[model samples]
Target: MSKVILITGGSSGIGKSVGNFLTKKGYTVFGTSRFPEKYPQSNFPIIRMDVTKPNSVTEAVASVIEKAGRLDVLINNAGVGITGPIEELPDSEIQKNFETNFFGPIRVIKAVLPVMREQQAGLIINVTSIAGYMGLPYRGIYSASKGALELLTEAFRMEISNFNIAMTNVAPGDFATNIASGRYHAPVLENSPYKQAYGNTLKLMDTHVNQGKDPLEMAKAIYKIINTPKPKVHYKVGEFMQKFSVVLKRVLPDKVYEKLLMNHYKL
Candidate 1:
């Protein structure tokens, strides 16, 4: 039998692309959405799920296992982006960002672990971002949330290795997706001191994302990870500059790297 794969936020963007690609590759793919009925014509099955809700995540995973008899892969790709100066962003907004980008994956991972443990083998992929490696101007919360997930995934790998399960943190740079349109913006009052800087940085961020890589590239990378017997603990996908930034952040002097990042974002 073909492998059964479940992907969150599969109604659109990277998750959708990965689901479609895997389905064509003969895997029984199931994608989750808050409103599954919206995609009645999707090539792969759509499950009703809100990753932020533990009950919703549990029910969705249960439905997949009931129908497929087994789940071989779980893709934690559901995430949200928030932008603004750290001082201006409300505490509630920061929590909301983490709810989706960080805790959402934790909810889904917890729901699937029991089944995967019983099976004694499975693969879990957490779709993080290059922003996870370093703080970004106007996107500090988004970066922090992804960075938190990356660290959690690293620890999770160690915990689950004994069960013969595999986990990978897939970090992609800017991608041409609707994420920017859907991103949350902290309320910028007319009198706010950081308003002009926020606007400039946000505009630049949008420009880079608009010119970013296609989501298909990420899908292909995911396919290879699923097929590999032992995939790397982490995978970075994107153009040269983006991938190199991760390496530079590690090897470059702290002050030099900070200067490079500030210069790149015009901060």
Candidate 2:
């Protein structure tokens, strides 16, 4: 029998692409959405779920088990994007972003572990971000949220290894998707000190997403990882420079890297 896969935020974007690809490859794929009804045209099943809601998470996982009898893979792809001058952004918005990006995956992971443990085999792919590797000009909150997930996976991997279940992180660089339109942008207040710089940085961030690589790249990468016998702790998918930036951060001097980022953002 083919492996059964469940992807949160599978109604659109990278999650949707991955689900479609896996389905075509003969995997029984299910995706979650807050409004599953909206995706009547989805190629795979869409489970009603809100990652931030505990009951919703449990119910979605349960629904998958009820139908599939066993779950082989879980993809934590449901996340939101937040961009703004960190100091200028409201605390509520920052917390909300973490709720979805960080806490949401944790909720789903916790829900599926028991089932995976009983089944004695499973794989989890956390959809993190390349932005998580560094604090970007106006995307500090986004970086922190995804960065937290990366760290969580590091620790969680060892804790769950005894169960024969595997966990990994997949950080993607900018991709051409509705994420730019969906992201929360703190208003550019004219009187604020960061007004000019923040506005320009916001435009740059959007342009990067608008002109970013295709989501298919991410889908193919995820499929390859799924087929691997033992997945690595972390994987990155994107253009050369985007992945290289992580390495650069590791090797470059602190102030020098800061200078490079400042110059790139024209700060």
Candidate 3:
């Protein structure tokens, strides 16, 4: 049977790439965006969804169920990144990051679980990041968000194993996507104490992101994991990320790993 897949934050970046690729592979792809009208009637039918809002998530799922009848896979790819030293960041910005990056997925999962449980088969692919495994210099908040998602996926996988539902956490390294530009920044950029300390790092972050792996490579890896006879709980998509970040993080000493990441980010 052709898989029916739903993806959040499908308007652009990796989510959009995955949606388009999956539709071409004969899967019925439905992507969610807050502005449903802005999303063209392309291969994937775009539905209005805002992960931070549980009601919006419920409405989106209802609409998808009305049309697709069955949701074979739900890809929690919606997320936002915020940068700054944890010490220098405001409490509100940090909370907002969690709302969009961590709790957003939780809301969508809650909305989709009932239907998937009743159907007795479904897959959930959470688009986490390499940051989930390691702490970075300026992206502490964003990393924390993904770290929460990683733990959530771990528990989700164990709890649903007997129910024929699979949860895979895709931890990709940096990719050539619009994430760097699209991330939200605090309004206190000019007046903040961290402005000088983190401003340059932010510029470097943007530059390095442009040099990252092709997003389509990660999209293909996601597709493969979904189609595998027995899917794994964790899937690392980027070549460099899978080679060094995920594997080394498990074996390397904490100080050594921290030093390596520090050097890479020039912190």
- Most lDDT-accurate candidate: 2
Worst 10 residues of 2 by lDDT: 82-91
Query: Tens digit of lDDT per residue, candidate 3, span 1-267?
Result: 788899999888899899989988999999999897986755688899988888999999999899988898999999888877787778998898899889999898888888899999888999998888777778888988998999999998888888888888998888889998878664436777777757778887887689888889978998898888678877776756445776788899988888887777666
Candidate 1 lDDT, tens digit per residue, 1-267? 899999999999899899999999999999999999999999999999998888999999999999999999999999999999999888998998999999999999999999999999999999999999998888889999999999999999999999999999999998998898888987666898987878778889889889988999999999999999998988999999899999999999999999998887776
Clashes in candidate 2: how many? 0
Checking candidate 2 for backbone clashes, the offending pairs are none
Instruction: Compute the lDDT of residue 94 as modeled in candidate 3.
Output: 89
How far does residue 134 in candidate 3 sit from its true spot (Å)? 0.9
Clashes of each: 0, 0, 0
What TM-score would candidate 2 get against the native?
Answer: 0.99
Model 1: how far residue 216 lies from native, Å: 0.5
Give the per-residue lDDT of model 2 (tens digit) for 93-188: 998999999999999999999999999999999999999999888899999999999999999999998999999999999899899888899999
Give the winner by TM-score. 2
lDDT of 2 at 29: 100
Q: After superposition, which runs of candidate 2 have C-alpha atoms over 4 Å from their true positions?
A: none
Task: Give the lDDT of residue 56 in candidate 3.
Answer: 93
Select the stronger candidate by TM-score from 2 and 3.
Answer: 2
